[model samples]
Target: MSTPELHWFKSSYSSSNEPGDCVEVAVASAAVHIRDSKTPHSARLAVAPSAWVNFLAVVGERR
Candidate 1:
């Protein structure tokens, strides 16, 4: 089966002036998708919604 179209949004950290240094996010069902803005058509990393939250928490704690 083919993948459905997803509504993607740019990361807040992504600047309009930047090209390759960008990230896009999309949420589908219970999974979150992350793709490189420069190669959006390529494969994206998928993570569980809960896992994504945990990942963000770790990143936040490190910051």
Candidate 2:
């Protein structure tokens, strides 16, 4: 099996300036992928859609 290409987008909170630490995310049918915007080729983290939703909910409550 092969991995399909993902369309990643930068986090809205990331700095608008270039050469800064940033986070990127890509949503797939099975998982949400997260990675550093600067080192895109580096290892990434993937979580189930449900887990991602739960995470957002938890984080939202703290805001």
Candidate 3:
């Protein structure tokens, strides 16, 4: 009948509230979700737990 609800929140990694560069995250039992903070209603990217960890590893390497 109706869509489910998601308690999305801004990523802690986002240091400042300047503008533009912002991302949000939501963790669920099945997947880790990411969406643009500027457009919360837009499409999002969902990844498995292991995949999320691997992705962070790569991002950490670059930074």
The lDDT leader among the candidates is 2
- For 1-63, candidate 3 gives per-residue lDDT tens digits of 854577888776675766667889988877999999888888999999899989888988877
Query: Which candidate model has the greater TM-score, 1 or 2?
Result: 2
Clashes of each: 0, 0, 0
Pairing residues by index, what is the TM-score of model 1?
0.76
C-alpha lDDT values of all predictions: 0.86, 0.88, 0.83
Q: Where does candidate 2 stray beyond 4 Å?
A: 13-19
lDDT of 2 at 40: 94
Instruction: Give the Å error, residue 47, model 2.
Output: 0.5
Candidate achieving the largest TM-score: 2
Each model's TM-score? Answer: 0.76, 0.78, 0.76
Which residue pairs show backbone clashes in model 3?
A: none
Q: How big is the positional error of residue 47 in model 1, measured in Å on the Cα after superposition? A: 0.7
At residue 47, candidate 1 shows an lDDT of 96
Each candidate: RMSD: 2.4, 2.2, 2.4
Please list the residue runs of candidate 3 whose C-alpha ends up more than 4 Å from where it truly belongs after superposition: 1-4, 15-20
lDDT of 2 at 56: 81
**Can you write out model 2's per-residue Cα lDDT over 1-63, one digit (the tens) per residue?**
999999999876566787568889899999999999879999999999999889888877876
Question: Order the candidates by lDDT, highest first — what do you get?
Answer: 2, 1, 3
